[model samples]
Target: MVKQEKVKVKPLPATIIPPTSWVKYFKEWHGLKFPVITCRPLGRLGNLMGEYATMYSLKRHYNVSVVMNSEFKSRIKHIFLNTSLPDIPASAGPFQLQDWTPVQNIGSLYNYAPIELAAAGLLGPKKFIMKEYAFEMQMFHQFREELKKEFTFAPNYTNKVNEFLSNIMKNRSSQLPDPVFVGFHIRRTDYKKFVKNKFGGHLPGTSYFTRALTHYRTKYPDAAVFVVASDDLQYARAELQQYQDVYFSQGFSAGQDMALLSSCNHSIITLGSFGFWTAYLAGGEVVYADVTTKHDYRFSRKSFEKFGLDYFIPLSVD
Candidate 1:
């Protein structure tokens, strides 16, 4: 057996609104500590960023241990770290939560969906006296810089995640891949109004995607464009039929999806959680559609900016 050197992580002040099993998973799988930070669901973005940034910023910070808080004993924990800025700052506008209602002024519906306005708003009166928007932006600016240092240097993705990646590369997993190997995501969970009216769309990024695939085909005619999507694969497969190796994955466990995503050499992401997480784990070059829809530009710009423009290929204008 290969002797593994244990990592030391600093005792985190508190973990933010992370997924329930996040701390426990970190402890058992990675041996990291993540004390829960009990902030409002849509509040404390600054504190959240600070906590992860500080903990991840240093190597050998401290050895961490956390108790599992999940239903399943063998359940694996998945940790998602996000610190991105929206194109049009929602918190900067006059739409404060106290003033806006959820009925019609759809812009302020849910903070994190279109933008993390609710979380930004949670900065509070006394602390956010001058300008909450500015504070949040600066906070992200600092946080991004800190994360860049950590993400680039250390293994931002967990060890179990890496093992999962290895398994997928060897093609020994439940989630089977189709020929082309295309990665895509459906962000229909939100956009309730759009869902009702059937007007909401995939950020108008489909066109950008077709063009990217066309370019990829020109270079590597034999390489299959494997796609990982949150929605049904039939639609995308039917549309993108011309590719030589086009494939999509059936809906599977988060760990399964994450593993499959990391094994891909190239991918495309939508403007939603599923896609965001997949692309991040892919650790490969990605292509993003330049979204023109309301509030979508936030994710389009943020994902590219947050992860690194180098990893993304934006949809073309014109």
Candidate 2:
């Protein structure tokens, strides 16, 4: 792991609001010349990607320096190759949380990207702050290919997953020289409630996996190899024991697990930030569980416009 101690930003005093949206009279204090936008990310890997990607997207738009919060700087820096940024000290942050601008998180709302507002806000050079949850938005699209370059997993992780895949392939009687590896992410645990309340009561179960596996089988026909990774390994093993060409990835850390799944030709997600990213990095036909109810905003087609065709498929959870 790389040491995350260095910082390039020198914190400065907050400058008065400039130009429009109601401007206050203020002289230009030349002390704050280059504006620094801080990327304040919360939650786990999924949320961090959104936060950082938003900031990265902002840097592309605003053409300024981007910084990361010290807390998450170390946790996520190792996952990707290009997450090089200065860490912000607490002193640089605003006295009150509300002091920071409220930027709308319409990354999911693909049809309209606020051209005027970067992930932080569109304004002249002055230190600005940002806040959480953005892994699945269209606003992050422009830098996505670049984001992929930035997010490419460490070589150690890739090697580990590759070795595991090789071993699994060797055991199979049929040798597909160019097998289509299909990754499956079974997200259980907290999702039972999160989905019930936020999206709908429906959740992916054994049937959901079987259906997804069946669909992939019909599509790839001869060369579909299923590689299942999950928070609940025992559940996945038990449920999928009857199927052939299916293998479980074990003895790896969470980061390694993500590396294994994202290396596949496609993905099957059961709804969560982790699953969302795995499918995204894999960049193929992504089949996600429809956790949203009929009118739920989370399941809108317009929201997922950035994705390719046949990305979502609703299956019987029971």
Candidate 3:
């Protein structure tokens, strides 16, 4: 037998940007001298949406580059596969930090001033860095079509998503004619703390899920298969097992899980931007938890409105 050669997996480069290269690149791209807008994204996958939205909005007017926090680089690559967004290379020379602008509050209140304001600031000769969550969904609304092109899943994850859907469909074919895949995202783990702190009233209970499931069953009685995606798979499996034709996604990365969730025909989402993004990408019927009572800092009604999903059913836990 011939000896098998092992393929080596290359580690991600320490820095994507070369020192002082950003300043030079910016001038060339615009065909004139211009300030560099470097955006530093913070937090996990959900919060990154806000940062990306801000970047997307800024890109329309100014030269923008993302300086991703070291921890989230892998996650970013997984979620935004084969996409090209101008990112500040790790080796790029130091960026001139600017005053932190509080855009989340302004964007939350349905104001467009922040976008224009940031653009106006870039008109000056000085390079600047934006330090904010910039979680405004509206910032991305105008360019959503363009954004969708940039936020596609990588091929490996895409294949897994397709496989999951195929398996669910095949399993359900015997029980019902034309089974409808309904994705449910039960965000627990850290969200439990949010509940304990009275951040969002109370965590959505089993009753809320059951009620939402029943509504779908009634509407699509032909057949419905619930594909559950959650941080706590064991708890999710136990809690949702009462319903027939229920299934749980096997161990998968968060990016893979979101791809599966987005592939469904319908979505049952709880709190968090991750769920919101899955439902948004699914572009199907959605039933979300009504956590309006909990004044969670990240939860924003305006964000949902910006998605143009007026028909989403909000199931109240209280």
Candidate 4:
């Protein structure tokens, strides 16, 4: 006799609880079955990374099986070597199938689960949909090494990144010894308004980059090259072209750009999740505009705390 895969079907409504209702996300689970979780990805690459990492942490820490929907894989899997998590199809829109409970996350939302809850069961129903916008960076550091291995750039991306890095290093003058690369992620576009409204952040100007670059130069001297990647490349070049030893990496997918940046010595990030992940992967001293959100918001603090105690962005510099 063949075994049957049990699946439950229902239409779960979009979940958006006001601050008054956060208590429910942490509420007790009374379901008889152990929960099986799968996160539905939302937003672009940066947001997708955060969502996957959150679920990835749960899968590792809680010792439960976590799955990914096919859309998540189509958007995320190819960039990394090990998107090894199992996947299911979610082609039918807004329809929840079999034991799956919907999890709605506002920006940077995290559904907290304790070890006690993990014991014998994983907090809730037969299945969970860790719906998007889940930026749980706090515990992400705990699984950092495994995450790095899992998110390692695919072979093609690695090769392109290697060539880019090699060319940048080889073409530099002998006058600049002991070459060091400083990856600069200058975030533009919608951020000017988005940061202001959401986190009370201001978009940095050229002086911000100059100040950050100066910090690197003082430490690495002429050996430092500011390799910039930005949405507005033309504007970036216009703003900082006067600076010596500056290079701009253009015409690469975000994955390839990230691979190149991560291979570098250090990072300078303005603001935005893209910048955050690039710096996270680079794993070195980080310099940011002092304009980065000072007092973190309710759920977004994890994004800030992952940088740890070491950063070189003083108010006076900005």
Full-model lDDT for every candidate: 0.38, 0.64, 0.63, 0.65
TM-scores, all models, native as reference: 0.46, 0.75, 0.76, 0.77
Which 10-residue span in candidate 2 carries the lowest summed lDDT? Answer: 1-10
User: Highest TM-score among the candidates is held by which one?
Assistant: 4
What would the per-residue lDDT of candidate 2 be over residues 1-318, giving only the tens digit for each residue? Answer: 111122233322112222254212232222322455565567877778767776776566544556675656777877776665555545555334444444434545322233224322444434556653544354456565787887888888888987998987787666455578998998877777776776555667876677788878888876888888888888888989788778888836778888898899988887677777777788887776644454344433324442322344444444
- Cα RMSD for candidates in order: 15.1, 10.3, 12.8, 12.2
Counted clashes in each candidate structure: 25, 1, 10, 3
Candidate 3 — what's its lDDT? 0.63
**Candidate 2 segments whose C-alpha is farther than 4 A from its true place:** 1-34, 84-125, 174-177, 294-302, 306-318
Worst 10 residues of 1 by lDDT: 125-134
What clash count does candidate 1 reach? 25
Candidate closest to the true structure, highest lDDT: 4
Q: Candidate 1's residue-wise lDDT over 1-318, tens digit each?
A: 111222333322222233332222222112222321111111132223332333232211222221212211112223333322111122334323333222111333222221122222222211111111111221233344445433221233445445544444466333544334445554444443443344243444356556766655665555445554445456555565565344455445444455456456667765544465456445556666555454433345543454334556665522
Span of ten consecutive residues with least summed lDDT in model 4 = 1-10
lDDT of 3 by residue, 190-302 (tens): 87785667554556878777877887888788687788898889889889887666888885778888888888889988887778777767767888776655343444343
Q: What is the lDDT ranking, best to worst?
A: 4, 2, 3, 1
Cα shift from native, residue 279, model 3 (Å): 0.6
